[model samples]
Every structure is written in C-alpha cells, then in structure tokens.
Target: MQSMTGFGRAEHADDGLIARVEIATVNRKQADIHFSLPRELTALEADLRKLVLRFISRGRANISIHLERVSGCDDSFSVDPDRARALETAFNKISDLIGRPVALEASDFIKAPGVLTFSNSVWDVNEAEKAIHPALETSLKNLVQMRKAEGADLKTDFLKRLNTLETYSSVIGKATSNVVERQRELLHNRLREAEIEIDLNDERLLKEIALFADRCDISEETTRLASHINRFREYLDSSEPVGRSLDFLCQEINREFNTIGSKANDAGIGQSVVGAKTELEKIREQVQNIE
Candidate 1:
C-alpha cells in the first residue's frame, strides 16, 4: 500500500543552470498534475507529465521548477545599432535638460536591446531531455519513499481499527442471541406498568413479537459485514493500488452498520453497532490515503 500525499525536492547541475524541482501531492480520485516551469522548458512538459503519471495513480500534484541559467554564458551578443542610437539620443537629451554632463558608456549601452545573449542550445530538445532525467528521477524516488512511509503509518492505524471492529462484531453477535427473550421481557414490563392483565396466549401479542423479531434480526447484515471485512483485508494485502476497492468496501460496511443500528432495539446491540460504525468511518478516511 502507498499513500497519495507526499513532497519531494531535487536539484541538478545543468550546463549553466542549476535546475530545481519540487513536487507535492495530495489525495484525489484521479491523477492530475499542475506544473510550473520556465519558458525554455515548455517543450519538455509532455515528457514530464508522462513521468509523473508513471509514479502516481491517484493524486492532485503540484510541480514547481526553478532554473538559474547564467546570462551571456554561451554565445556573445551583437549590438542593435538602432536601439543603441535611440538610447544614446535619449541619454544626451536627458543630460541637457538636467544641465549636467552624462558619460555615454558601454554600461549605459548594455541596457539596449540585444546587449545580452542566450545560447542557441537553450531551447534544444535534447539538452532539455538530458537535464530532465536526473532531477526527475531524484524527485520521484524521494516522493515514493515519503509516500511509502506515510502508508505504513496509515496501515498501522487501519489495522488497529480493524481489530476494534472485529471485537465489536463479536459483541454484537453475542447480544443478538437474547433479543427474542428480551422482547418478551419488555412486553411483560410494559403490561405491568399499565396495570393491565395481559393474556399470555393473545394472538396480537404473538403476531407482534414475530414481526418485531423479523425486523430486528440483523443476521443478514452481520453476514454481509463479515464478508466485506474479509474482502477489505484481502485487497489491502495485494500489491496493486486498492484505494477504490477499499472505498467500496467501506461504503458496504457503513451501510450494514447503519442497518444494524436501526434494527437493533437492545441497548447493548445499539452500542456495539455504534462502535462498528465509528471504526468503519476511520477505515473510510484511511482509505483516502491509499493508492
């Protein structure tokens, strides 16, 4: 089992850029990615998306990247005569207006267009691909490790709840046996409280007890809940991502517990059903982390 929430950060030394990437994931029903990268790296988006999908099955992921490529590191820039002339004229006019002498220097010209340059290889598909692998691999591996650790904790908590559920199910079973006798005792108490002579062989009493017992009998729900628990644990043992399966089983368990709670009139049975429901709710929440 693996959790869908994790965070990872990686940095790689590119030709002139130290490429940094950070990934954070949160649980979702489907795999969705949000990316932030430099303009020069846009061409590599598809490949990065594929890589992310390979590692994650269900999560909403945010990927952020920072690139620090040295300016004018590759090829020398050429001056644009028109841009330099315009800047030079503006500088001279500004100096004249201020009644001051301003030096027309290379530093002033550096602000002109095309003064700084970029490598032709900056947009190279191959270069981008090459730089991608290292950072991506590092980030993915760390993300997987973090998710695994989180899943281990979730598994421990889930197993404890499962044990609680098992104990509660046993209590409910034992409580179920005396329900018929309990109803009879309740009927006697009610009649005495009303100070009425009750007929032991009353047809209405017989029909009502049978009806009540039929309504309160949670054998069907108990059987189904046990079967669902078995399947739930079985899915957890498998290698495949079982979030959906676990979610489905949680719904089944919740439904059965709800029925048991409604059908049971005995205080002990009701309390046990409530315990089972509480554990089932915890199971449901833990399932959100599974992937």
Candidate 2:
C-alpha cells in the first residue's frame, strides 16, 4: 500500500555539473505528471515521464529539474561576441554622454548580463541523461518510501474504523433479531384497542402480518453488508493497489446500510444503521488518499 501525498529531493554532482531533482505528489484519480526542466533538458521529458510512471500509478506528480555548474566553475558558458559588440557600442555612447572616454575593462564585460550564455548542452543527450538519471531515480525512491510509511498509518486507522463498523452491524443484528414477533404483538394490541374483535388466526390477518414481516425484513441487507465488510478487510492487506476497489466496496456497503435503515422500522436498528453509514463515510474519505 502507498499514499498519494509525498515529497522527495536528490542532487547528483558529476563532471563539474550538479543535477537536482525534486518531486511532489498529491491525490489524483489518474497519473498526471508536470515537469519543470531546463531548456537543454526538454528533449528528455518523455523518457523522464516514463520513469515517473514506473514509480507512481495514480497521483498528480510535479517534477522539477535544475542543472548548474559547480561553484567557481566557468566551463559551461560561452561569450556571445555579437552581444559583446552591442554592449561595447552602448558603453561608448555612455562615455560620450559623460563627455569623457570610459575605459573598457575585461571584468566589466564579463560581468555584463547577456554577454555570456549557457552552452548548448542538449547537443549530447546521452551526457545529459547520465547526469540526471541518478538524481531522478533516487528522488523517486525516497518518495515511494515516504508514501509507504504513510500508507501503513492509514491502514491502521482503517482497521480501527472497520472495527467500529462491525460493532454497529452487531447492534443492528441484535435489535432486529425478533423484529417480526414484536411487530406481530404490536398489531394484535392495536386491533384490540380498536375493538375490532377480529379472529386472531383469520387468513386475512395472517396474510397481512406475513406481508408486513417480509417488507420489514433486513436479513438479506445485513448479510450483504457483512460480506462487504469482510471484502474491505481483505483489501487492506492486499499487495496491489486497491484504492479503486475499496472505493467501490464503500459504495456497496453504504447501499446495504441504506436499505437496512429504511426497512428496519425500529429506532434501535435505525440508529445502528446510521452509525455504520457514518463510519463508511469516513472510510471513503481516507480511501481517496490511498494508492
């Protein structure tokens, strides 16, 4: 099991270049990857996306990659001669405006913006991949680790809630154990109070009671609800991703509870059905974060 929310970062330095990769993920129904890469590395986006998919099957992942030369290293830059000429012309105009000749210093030109540009590193795709792949893989591994850790915690909470659900189901079962008999007694008392003096064993009276018992019966619903709960417990221990499956089971469980609530016709069973539904709602909320 794994969670949909996690963060990871890694940096790799080689051949005077440092590659830094950061990944953040959040809950999403599908795998959605967004990347922030240097222009030189744009060509590698497809390959990088494939790697991300290998680690994450469902979530919105934001990946950022930065490549920079080591401090005090200047080998990755080239002077733009045309830009330098433009700067020189601008400097000459500035000197004239001041009515004095301004000295042209190498340091001044080197410090000027747009005079130097990063080299065309994309010319060698293999080299760029070599520098980035290690950092990217390490960051993804870290992200998976964090996700699994949180998933363990979520599993614990799910088990606790499942226990609560079972408790409510038990209460409903007990409350409805003799519901038919109770209803039959209530019907007889009502008939007596109305002074109808009808035959207790009349075919019409027995038929009406039988119909009422069938309508108020929730045995099928309770049985199905228990089955759904057991299926959910099995999913919690599954090795594969079960978020979607668990979500579907939650819906089924809620449906059973709804049926039970409506047919119960007793206050105690109705309250138990409500409690079970409440627990199922919470489980559904947490299931969204699972992967």
Candidate 3:
C-alpha cells in the first residue's frame, strides 16, 4: 500500500548548469499530473508524464523544474555585438543632435534587452533530458519512500479500527442471541401489569411471538458483515492500488451494519451498530488517501 500525499525534491549540477526538480502529490482517483517547466523544456512534458506514470498509478501530482547556471559562471552569456553597435550609433547620433557628447558605459548596454543573453542549454529534447533525468529520478524515489512510510502508518490505524468493528460485531451478536425469548418475557410482564389475564399457551399469542422472531432475524446480515470484514483485511495486504476497492467495500460493510441494526431490533445491538459505523466512516476517509 502507498499513500497519495508526499513531497520530494532533488537537484543535479553538471557543466555549470543546475537542474532542480520538485514533486508533490495528493489524493486523486486517477493519475493526473501538472508540470511547471521552463519554456525551453516544455517539449519534454509528455515524456515526464509517462515517467511519473511508472512510479504511481493514482494521484494528483505537481512537478516543477527549474534550470539555472552557476552563480559565477559567465561563459554561457554572450554579447550581441551587432545590436550593441547599433545602440551605440543611435546614442551617438542623439548626442550630436543635442550638441552634447554623451559617454556610453558598458553597464548601460548590458542591461538592454537582447544585448547580453545566456544560452538556453535545454532548448532541445536531448539536452533537456540530459539535464533533468537524474534530478527527476531522485525526486521520484524520495516521493515513493515518503508515501510508503505514511502508508504503513495508515495500515496500522486501519487495523486498529477494524478491531473495533470486530468488537462491536461481537457485542451485537451477544445482545441479539435470545432476542425472541427476551421479547416474549417483556410482553408477558406488560400484560400482567395491565391486569389483563390471558392464556400463556394461546395459539394466537404463540403465533405473534414467532412472527416477531422471524421479522427480527439477522443471521444472514451478520454472516455477510463478517465476510466483508475478512475481505477488507485481504485488500489491506494487497500490493496493487486498492483505494477504489476498499471504498466499495466500505459501502458494503455499512449496508450490512444498517440491515443488522434494523432487523436485530434491540437497543444494545443498535448502539453497537452506530459505533461500528463510526469506525467504518473513519476508515472510508483514510481510504481516499490510499493509492
């Protein structure tokens, strides 16, 4: 199991160029990725998305890549002599027209647009891959590591909640074990209190008790609920993505709990059902974060 929430970052420096990659993921039903890359590296988005698919099957992933030259590296920068010369000439002409000589400083032209430009090292697909692959791989590995660790914690929590549900299930079973006999005794006590004398062995009274027992029978529901719990444990041990499957099982489990609550018709059993439902709800919320 793996969680869908994690963060990772890595950087690779090569030949005066540095490539940094950051990836963050959150819960999502499908594999959805958004990329923020320099314009020169935009063409590599498709390949990057494919690479992410290999690491995760479901989540919303955000990937950002930043490329820069070493702080003191000036080799990648070049002056456009043609543009600089044109600018100098234009400035000189303006100075002569104003009848005053104006001195041109190198800093003045350096700040001009296009006067000095750094070469875009990752302008090609091959160069972009060379610059980014190492950082991207490292970041992805870090992300998976974090996700796995969180998943372990989630599994532990889920197991504890499952134990709670099992305990509640046992409580409900015990509460309803002799539900019919208990109801019959209560009915008899009520008749005596009302000063109504009636034959205890009357066929009509016996038939009513039998009907009540049949109506409140929940053997099938409890059996199914137990089976669903077992299946849920199996899913937790699965290596593949089980978020959707576990979500579906949550619904099945809740349905069984509902049936048991209604059919058992005992206050103690109903309270146990409510507690089990609360635990199941927590599990369902955690399931949404699984991948």
Candidate 4:
C-alpha cells in the first residue's frame, strides 16, 4: 500500500524551452486533480490529469507546470515598437508636467513592461508533451518509492499492534470462564445475608445466569476481528492502491473492538479490550493516509 501524501517534480530541458512539472499530493477520500499551467498549456490539462491519475489512484493532487525559453532554444530578441512608443510618450508627458527636459534612455524602455519580446520557434504541443513525460515519470517514481518505504514501515507497526489485539482477545476469552458461576455465587450470598430464602437449585436461576453470560460473550467479535486483520494484511501485499478500501476495513475492525469492549464486563477483560481498542484507533488514524 502507498501513502496518499507525497511530492514529485520533473523538468524537461529541450530545444529552447525549459518545462517544469511539479506534483504535490495529500490524503483524500476520493481522487482529485488540480493544475496550474500557462494559458497556452491549459488545453493539455485533461491529458495531464489523466496521466497523473494513472500514477495516483487515490489522493488530492496539485500539478504545476511552468515553461520558459532557455538560451539555446531561441536566443532571438526584439523590442515591441508599440510598447516602446507608449513608454516614451509616458516619460515625455511626465517630464513636461514636471517642467524639466528628461531623456528617455534605453534603460527606461527596457524596464517598462511589454517593451521587450522574444519570437519563439513554432513547436507542436505533442513534442513538448513527449519531452515532459520522462521528467514526469521520474517525479512520480520518486513519490511512489517513498510511499512504498513508508508502507513497509506502516506494515511493521501494524503487525505489532495486531499481535497486541490477538493477545487481548485471548485474555478476554480466558476471563469469561466461570464468570456466570461467580455471579451466581455472589447473588446467593447476598440473598442469604439479607435473610431472603431463595432456592439456588432452581432451573430458572441457571437459565438467567447462562443468558447473562451469553449476552457478555465476545467470541464472535474476536473471530471477526481476526478475519479482518488477515484480509487487511493481504491487501498490503498487492500493488494496487488500497487507501479507501483499507479505511473501511479499519472501521470494521474498530467496530468489532468496540463491540468486545462493551460486552465483556469482567474488569480484566474490559481493561485489555480498552488497550487493544486504543491500538486499533491509532492504526485507524494511519489508515486515512494509506494508499
């Protein structure tokens, strides 16, 4: 399983353009793709989104692409005549208003916005897309590699907690033994102390105690919890994204843990269940970020 949160960046330096692609991801219940690109590249958003989704099956992803001409790609430069004229007119008007003769220098024209321009060699969007693929692939590969490392660590932590849960399940089972008999003894002693003569040999008494014990039994819950754990481990072995499904499985495990805690009334069993539940809750917290 991979983590839903990660980052990847790729740069394609080809021809006269330096195209940079950066991707940031965060934990989310569903797949979401957002992009920041120049207006010219906006048309490619759908294709980029599809490519990103292929690498990331679950997460909210932020993708940013920036393109700029590098020195070797196209070095041709020119002045925008209209913009230069506009800037010169503004400077001359300002000088006249200030009652002074001012020289409109080359620096002034160069400093003005839109005064300088470059003519890029016409290029197809498809070629740029191909060049970006390698960089994009590298970035995603790095992100997934990190998530795999993290997932391995998460698996280790889960195994330790699962063992704890199993140990507590056993304790609950052991603590349940003779519990109804003990409750019967207590009730009999209390009645005798109160000077109330109640027949302990009645089948009704046995039936009542047995019914109470059955109500408190957590065996079914424990078995289901075990099954869920096994299934979860199996998911970790697969290459596919499992964040959403694992989240549901974690909830099921927590529900089972809660059920065991509520039904097991023996103090030892209850305490153990509480501890196990705490561990499960921690595991569940991590599940939200799992992929």
Candidate of highest TM-score: 2
Candidate 3 residue spans exceeding 4 A from truth: 14-16, 70-116, 120-122, 194-196
TM-score of each: 0.78, 0.84, 0.82, 0.81
Alpha carbon deviation, residue 157, candidate 4 (Å): 1.2
Please give the lDDT score for candidate 3.
0.87
| Candidate 1 segments exceeding 4 Å error | 11-18, 68-123, 192-204
Best by lDDT: 3
Model 2 / residue 95 / CA error / Å:
22
**Candidate number with the higher lDDT (1 or 4):** 1
lDDT of 3 by residue, 115-202 (tens): 8776754345575677688889889999999999999899999999998998998888778778989988888888899998878887
- What is the C-alpha lDDT profile of model 1 across 57-170, one tens digit per residue? 898999987765556565644556777778879889989999998889877776555543444424555665666668977898899899988888888888788888878878
Candidate 3 local lDDT, residue 201? 89
Candidate order by TM-score, decreasing, is 2, 3, 4, 1
Off by over 4 Å in 2: 75-124
Candidate 4, 34-106: lDDT as tens digits: 9877555567778777777778888888877776677655567778899988888888899999999889888
Candidate 1 CA-lDDT value: 0.81
Q: Provide the lowest-lDDT 10-residue window in model 4.
A: 117-126
RMSD of each: 5.0, 4.8, 5.3, 3.9
